[model samples]
Target chain A: MARILAVDDSAAMRQMVGITLTGAGHDVQQAADGAEALEIAERQKFDLVITDVNMPKMDGITLVRELRNRASYRYVPLLVLTTEATLERKQQGKAAGATGWLVKPFNPERLLATIAKVLG
Target chain B: MPSSARPFTGASELAGLAPVAQDASQLPPALPGFESFQRFWDRDNGCWMVKILPGEYYVSRSEEAISTVLGSCISACVRDPTRGIGGMNHFMLPQDATQGPNDWLDPAIGLATRYGSYAMENLINDLLKLGAVRERLEIKLFGGGRILAAMTDVGGRNIEFIRNYMTLEGYRVAAEDLGGTQPRKVVYFPASGRARLRKLRPVENRIISHHEQLYLDSLGKQAAGGEVELFD
Candidate 1:
């Protein structure tokens, strides 16, 4: 099972992600916002990082940028989870080195599929 | 889904406003003495509403009533049956005296309070003046989800503020489901004092933008800037 880091500002979203990923047989860790995610990433190795874009005390884009700058995370998969599905934002994420984007309220199957494609 | 099979008129147009239905069998059984209430439709808003009225001779009952609220701000529900009336309010933010009176809600910031405790006190006093007894009052709280994730920590702050306020005021909170990623569509049945919560999936960016615009207008703020990016 892969160790995954899930970050979001909403307690409910974090709980949902933790439940879904753990049920899929992956070990999960959670952070309330991007800043917390950064701190956790520094202390441990994770197979994947799933993050929400809109958060306080730092955001997903900034997290992706910082993660990409680290040598160990250069190729590690990073997926952005967001409510925004705009083409422009997608383009921005791709340019910042995100592996893929998953929209919020995603079906469990869709989330699993995306995880397989990114982490497999 | 065939067009004719859709139950709502203007189903296509109303698609945006459609409510997500969950299986009732999956829910826990209702509490004893609590019956499911009536549901109403607001044609103008294209939304369904439910009301649960208090039962007959419920005066001896010690249970607190619960209600749901969904919006950018807070919803305060006040109940004092001796006065024989209760009401709920939805506000955008803790009142700021300097912001000028809210033209629509009667713009007196002094009339408003930043902390939920102050707000609750004001509400209780009003109810009391209307003949509500302080000792017999009970409250059910809802709403305070962070609609603007980027601009404020108001939702989290509001939740904490309310919880603490209730403790200091000696009011018992009978039931609560708060702090979530999704927007909620809440129903407060004043009569029976039960709140039903339905979690709403995030809508499209276009709709979000529309709602945000409406919110800004209500606050008397200019909406000229480009949409604030939700994430960095």
Candidate 2:
């Protein structure tokens, strides 16, 4: 099982991600926003980082770029999950070092399948 | 943002059947950030339609109407009349079999209540980002029925959570049709801030309940079987 970091400004979303990952046998950590996620990542190592865009402080794309700058997370997987689904936004996320993009209202099975492929 | 609750006008006219001529290909594309919703042309309603299911929302700037059916769930219809931008969200508080409805509010255990907040925040934030003014917003609430009779009054708790949320945010509610024994089908026009709600009886309620329960169950971990490749 992978150790994953889940970040979102919405408490409910954080909880949902937490429950889903934990139930899947992965060790999960939570952060309320990108800044907090960045702070936590500095001290701990995780297999994957999933984040939401449009947060109050430091959105997900910025976080992905920042994480890539760190040696430990240079090759770690970073996924963007948000309501924004335009081609332009996906391109922006890809440029920011995100491994993949999943739109909001994600299906749980689909999310796991995607994660499995990335982790492999 | 404070505004007088505008009277619910044009609901009947909006619900009246229109002769639809556009095919699926002719329907306008969904607004940005709402690409996941099922968008179609509703022949019965005579307009472009977007249908949102549990744990989903759709925002529109065009002339499309959003629709959903609720069973022990709630749908919030919010829009900025001046900007002609609005959206609808359907959500339910997570259910814990061991805890009572109000007990889900405990910070450590209240994931349920927080999910409701997440749904509203996302919908409202999307509207604001689309150039909608907060004070000019019109809000309407629907759903929350005692359809899940075997379980705790989750529907009632959902109603309380949203009402308290609106009050805390200083948003005024213009109209609502909440708390009953039957499921409801709601169709809303965000640009016009109009809605048509019809309560369903036994036949549809069973279907709605089954779907909602499946949504809740899917939130838990399941066997991974499908393939979804990552784009790198």
**iRMS, all models:** 15.9, 7.3
lDDT scores of the candidates, listed in order:
0.56, 0.77
In the predicted model 2, the residue pairs found to clash are none
Task: State the lDDT of candidate 1 residue by residue for B1-232, as single tens digits.
Answer: 7755656533224666443342433233332323453333443333334332211111112222333335444565666655445545444333333343222112111112222323343345445445566567657676666655556555665576666556644677766656665566655544455555777665632454355445544442211111222222
Per model, how many backbone clashes are there?
A: 8, 0
Error of 2 at A95 (Å): 11
True contacts kept of each: 0.00, 0.15
What's the residue-level lDDT of B162 in candidate 1? 67
The candidate that achieves the highest DockQ relative to the unseen native structure: 2
- Candidate 1, overall lDDT? 0.56
Candidate 1, A1-120: lDDT as tens digits: 899999976554565567668878999999977999999999998999988777667778889888999987898899887655678878888778888887643234456677887776
Listing candidates in order, what is each one's chain A TM-score? 0.96, 0.97
Candidate 2 docking class: incorrect
